[model samples]
Target chain A: MSVMASTPSAPVKPKSNTRLRNTLTFWAFVGPLALGLLVFVYIPIVWGFIISFFEARQTVTPSQFVGLTNYVDMLTDPNFVKALVTFLIFAVFIVPTTFFLSLALALLVNNTTKGTSFFRTVFFLPTACSYVVASMTWRMSIFNGLPFGFANIVLGWLGVAPIQWINKPDPPYFWIVLVTVRLWLQLGFYMILFLAGLQEIDRALYEAALVDGAKRGWQTFRHITFPLLRNTSVSILLLSLIAAFQAFDEFYNVLSTGVGSSSNITLARPPLVYIYQVAMADQNYGRGAAGAFILVAIIIAVTIVQGRLFGLGRAEA
Target chain B: MTVNTQTDTGRRVIDRSERIAIVLNYALLIFLSIIFLIPFYVILRNAFLPSKLITAFDWTWLPMPPSTNGWRDLLANTNANIVDGLRNSLVIAILQTVGQIAICSFAGYGLARIPFKYSNIVFYAILVTLMIPGAVTFVPLFVLVASFGWISTFQGLIIPGLFSGFNTFLFRNFFLNFPKELEEAGLMDGLDHFGVFFRLVLPNSMSVMMSLGVITFIGAWNSFLWPLVIGQRSETWTVQIVLSTFMTAQTVNLPAIFMGAAVSILPLVIVFLFMQRYIVEGVKMSGIKG
Candidate 1:
């Protein structure tokens, strides 16, 4: 070890060989993944972008260049516009609701000295269940519009008439189905995140606040806990925003009359679902690809605005 | 004497309020737990109940005459092909998880540890992909997969999902904090970088691997849209597809759908129950570091 340390520099030939080996090692590790990302992710994205400008119809590779016709069509299409509105409404509703609910759950779990793990596990178990399963359970049993359905049974006991949850979109009771299933599926996952954030708070600070006459519950939380949880809150907000933008599975499963009959449910279609219909069902690949870019653009814009609002990157700097 | 009496009363008041608060906390937690567990209960109850009872106007909290009819029907139904679905889903999920961990760990380790000249460029490129959601790429990806003649094959289901920027990102963060001395020792023993990574780095990374593996498995298992698209053939249908088929079938077999959901969820539930400690730890790590 002493002799090796005393040797100031390796011989030039061996040194170059080592450098070559190091480079080879680096590529050996990173090359497959880079190639994969290029083929699977980057290539498809570029291809999608190119096809979006063409009258691609049934074929992904098209001879005709429509030049923004697909974009214009998607923008003008009422269904696409409504899908954007649906996303906006979903983001507005789910973002804050999930934030508070998860945070509250985290706070409650954090406060408890016993059965913390039990509560955490119980809450998080739903995250394992598939969206299709949750959507089916919620649609068929809980909000099934039948007199025996769980929600209607409660309404019956209250002397109120049974409401058709999904079929009758007039009152938009389906939003309840949509929102509740989403909440059940995702609430615990985010709660676990918030719980992690809550645990990071300095216990000493809470004690200091207590000695300084800050009340135990709300006062202490407001001044100390909430302020410290800014980072977690911002990240959770961003994640939920992206999730809202990508809302497809639940909406498609719940609202659609059935498989192959997805075109029937015209109400509450998110952009992905709408794009899916345009591309896969109708074989209008150009419009579908175009709508996808539009959605991506909106997502990027929202993320930027949210980052600015929350001062996301500035804190790290 | 008056001061002492006043202090005792103050202590008593504080104790009573604290007790009430504790009780309220437990009450709220229990209430939330019930709400959380209701869907699971509903699934279990309805899966065992007869179709007539399930659709009846009178609500039964429990399946009084518990029956195996739904489970039997789900297994016996040929079009549903639940057994095939389960096998396909398991194979796809396992392959995807293993492949993802391998590639992501390699890229992550390289980006984090190797002094490669263009590593930053590659890292940023990978990060940029995270912004491009899967919905944006599935169409052309579908076309590309079709071009490869991989539609309805395991290659279509598992291969595209193997390269997740998010997983790579997490792995990079993890490896960045890995002890350098251990790798230096391995290098001193004349092991190459590959050797060090395989023998030294990966073995010590069981926790992160287990956690990420569990996550990837669950995601792959529960994935709906991709499989729904790629695995259009009944032979390649995953459990999720099978579950969706029950609802989408012309008859809408409620009993069979519930049973399928219960079965579909079972593997993940077992996985979660076993690896929950690592799972929670993973979430905490990601939340704090990500």
Candidate 2:
């Protein structure tokens, strides 16, 4: 190929020149993005790691190094610990719930022969909605702590007393608001993923199963469909786990009193929200940076564990 | 003859069961669809209703004597500066999408096609960045932006978001599968690698580019945390930030808030409706390839 591309006259000199030119072209293509990744991503992360070791109060660049004191302080703080616990409970609740619901939706949508697109569209529409807007809608209108609110209205029809969904966190009905809103916003996106996975399964497999006396609904699914969907399910589980850890916008918009007002509702504050307060609101950059690292460690650890458990890169049967 | 009758009955039984299953499937789909759509219906209805009716003890399915009070209040509220927020969001999302596509695609093509000595090293470096979650770098990135004096500026909002390792990875995957014969033909016509990429590869890869562009645009429009950190000033706020203020502001105007939410969602809804195919395809690709 190189011989054909070189000049007919003075082939040796032209070949070397072409090689040099190819190397330059490669740099021209990849240099800008590599530079960007270094400047924006790599530098900030390294800087944050350094800052986590110091007492960075009201400033990012601190003079005094505190040698893991910031980490110790964050670990010992009840609020920080509580945030971690909150994230744990949230991940426990949301990851499986989203996984199952989205898979169920994909199954339901995929089974239907008519109006499949309509159902998919209706479900996926919420994925386009921002968490801020969805949180507002959930907090103000649907799950608002008033008799006229949507949830209360439904409760009234069911002969249950009007419950203050968010304000009074006792009995912890606030989880209802949080869980349902997140479910509504995310279910469709994951369903689409599962749907794609479902489509890739050979139609002949199901036919073979049926001929082997497998029933259509659960029996076939349990034997064939579910096993085939393992890869999709695992990836979805991982993605949802990450998303649940990053649950700040809804927690902030729904629970906090107002802009810049300290939140009195402290039940479900995730690590990101807590870190945001520590770093942005309280101006304790050291503690906040330390907290951020802890969250990252948890995410990375969970992802690795999940990947190992699933045998992620192993070839499919 | 008796055995034949038995088989016929069994077949009929199976058909009946299948029909019942089909009915149940449609029933569940419709039920779930309504549940999915209820929030949109509620938001739209509430946005057009007066505040009193929104909180009234008696609820109406439809907003009666519909008033534009919410929309009017939202527009007149000077502190929110929602119009400015919308404009800024549009500018930021558009610029970021264009820049990301150009830069990431170029890198992706080179990494996939070019035989550079250090390609593997560069590829692994990019791959490793994907593991570092955004939370780990949020504070320091903010500090970096601040040091550059980019706070409350378009540069802060647009530039940091332009280079996604994941996007570059996607482009590389796409280019790897691109037909080599086409590129060789271009080479035969006396074009260099850059010329072939610009004239042949890019044009042929429009579907992937379009799908990725739509996904990036929607993501940029809907992003919250970074814009909140950087665009502190009202003049630089994205629509998401503006809608957030309506909920968290000192005076919580319920109607105006609903109206703002409705308005903020409009652009994305339009984009989704128009590019629904590409958006879904892009998501499907991410799931399959990631």
- In Å, residue A118's CA in model 1 sits off its true spot by 0.9
Worst 10 residues of 2 chain A by lDDT: A258-267
Evaluated at residue B194, the lDDT of candidate 1 is 89
lDDT of 2 by residue, B1-290 (tens): 99999999999999999899899889888888888999899988988888888889888888777889988899899997888988998999999999999999999999998878889999999998888777556887887787788999999999999898888999999999999999999999999999999999999999899899989998899888899888888889999999888887778777788888888889889988888999998998777532
Per-candidate alpha-carbon RMSD to the true structure: 2.8, 2.6
Badly placed stretches (over 4 Å) of model 2 are A1-12, A259-262, A312-317, B288-290
DockQ of all models, two decimals each: 0.69, 0.74
Q: How does model 2 score on DockQ?
A: 0.74
Whose DockQ is greatest here?
2
The reply for model 1, stretches above 4 Å from the true place, is A1-10, A259-264, A312-317, B285-290
lDDT of 2 by residue, A1-317 (tens): 76675547666786788888878998899988999999998888788889889988887787689999989999999998998898888888898999999999999999888888888999999998999889988998889888998989999999999888887658888888888899999999999999999999999998998888888788989988998898898889888888888888888888988535456448688888888888988888878878888877887788788777677456544
A6-77: candidate 1 lDDT, tens digit per residue = 576657656788778777888888888999999999988788888889988777676589999999999999
